[model samples]
Target: MSYDTDIFNALRHRLMTNGFEHGQKVRAEHLRLEFGCSASTIREVLFRLSTIGLVEFREQRGFRVPEQSRALIHELTHLRVLLEAEGTAMSIRRGGVAWEARLTAAHHQLSHLEMRLQSARDTAPFVDLWFDAERHFHETLISACGSDALRDTHQQIYCRFRQQLMIEDRAFDFISENIRHHQQILDAAMAGDEALTRQKIHDHLARHLITDAQVEPA
Candidate 1:
């Protein structure tokens, strides 16, 4: 990857993982020194991240991590439910054997990761891996929907909510239940039960929407 792309991805991951505090100032000079790049390159990378809503840019204030709000979380989560439900139903109808195989593989990976996380004495070490697997499993579910626009929109919403999830540190508590939900959704999809699959998706996502603690003053 190019230097700018690498820097962009690293910065994005840090932002999503809460390595930088919410609303933390991200100075171009600071980033330039950290990444060993020119000021222009850092600005370009920050601008790219801003476009994705991971960072915010003010005319005179430069860039900072975007702050989260309960209202914004609810809006994003609601939109995700609508998009994912419709996309999943379309995937169920349009998916071929290859898609099924991919979905099954993704689920298997996620299930195994969840099992490991559950048994481990400390789940903190496995959080990132579990989240990666979880994302893969969900993406696999709708991979065959044949709508780039739908998939892209779903991805953006998913990323935003995932960042919120990481910030709140509540995902660990839901691991077991999350695994069960994914299993149920997979079962419904494999059986070609569109209604059940959509319902499962909605239930699973709705469970993670804004919690009281997330909105409390920071």
Candidate 2:
């Protein structure tokens, strides 16, 4: 029972990273051998991951990592911009110095890694660490939004968004621009400019939004 989280996280991390090729079948029997659990247990874990859009099931194909969808990516990107913008605005209003400090701390950690990544000839060694730090900064931007429902929903969207980022951008070619965007967002939030903060967040992810994705003003 206690190890259930370990199993779930193990599978979730794999799906998020390069562990499984897009649309590759996930085998319960193979995972069962690795975890020393029943195939049924592995199936249960994969089912949970499916709910988060990291995995999918077909009529008879069992479980597999989802195929990347340009449409789905655009939709998820729009939602992320909306949720993150609104949440950050709320945090700026409600969260005071404490929230700012946490946000600053999170940004510092993320930016440090981004700077290193900016110049590295090989990014593989820093990939996972950079992803974790990046997620932490965006998450902290809304940590003080004070609504569990909003936070929970954003988390689900973010997981899918992160997975998409992994699939589409392995080389980190835009890492320089990303570093700038992250810094600007932090500056806006720190200066208590809600509108600007919202805009910065949107700008950071605007590339992901297809031209057809008509995002409303934040």
Candidate 3:
């Protein structure tokens, strides 16, 4: 990858993983020195990240990590549910044998990873891997929706939601519940039951559409 792309990915990952605090100032000079790149390159990377809602640019304050809020989280969760549920229903109607095969494979991989995570004594490091599988499984479910725009939109919103969820320090119990929910959704989708799939997707996401007061203290 090009240097600029590498810097952009690294910075984006850091922001997603909460390596930088919310609303923390991201000075271009410091990032340039840290990344061993030019100031303009750092600015470019920051601007790209800002476009994705990971960072924000103010009139004179330069860039900073976007602040997290319960309202924002609820909004993102609602939007994700709407897009994913409709996309899943569309995929169910349009998907063929090939899509079914891919969805089944994705579900198998995700289930295996989740089982391993459940048994592991130290699950922290493996959380990211499990999340990868989870993302793959969900994306595969809607891959046959036949709308590039919808898929792209879902991806962006889902990325932001996942980052915000990680910031919330999602509890192990919640993670276990989420795994079960994924299995339920997968089962419904594989059966080509569009109604059940949409319902499952909405029910799964409702857990996240809560206020800060409703979130379990970690």
- Choose 2 or 3, whichever is better by TM-score: 2
- lDDT digits (tens) for residues 32-96 of candidate 1: 99888899999998898888787889998899877776677787888888988899899988998
For each candidate, the alpha-carbon lDDT, in order, equals 0.84, 0.87, 0.84
* Top TM-score hit: 2
Tell me which of candidates 2 and 3 scores higher on lDDT: 2
lDDT of 2 at 128: 89
List the pairs of residues colliding in candidate 1: none
Clashing pairs in 3: none
Question: TM-score of predicted model 2?
Answer: 0.93
How many residue pairs of model 3 clash at the backbone? Answer: 0
Q: Report the lDDT of model 1 for residue 170.
A: 65
> How many angstroms is residue 145 displaced in model 1 relative to the true structure, after the best TM-score fit?
1.1
How much does each candidate deviate from the true structure in C-alpha RMSD?
A: 3.2, 3.4, 3.1
lDDT string for model 2 (1-218, tens) is: 55667899988887777787777888888889999988777887888888878888776778887778777888899999999999999999999999999999999998899889888888889998988998899899999999999999999899887777676776488888998999999999999999999999999998887784354444
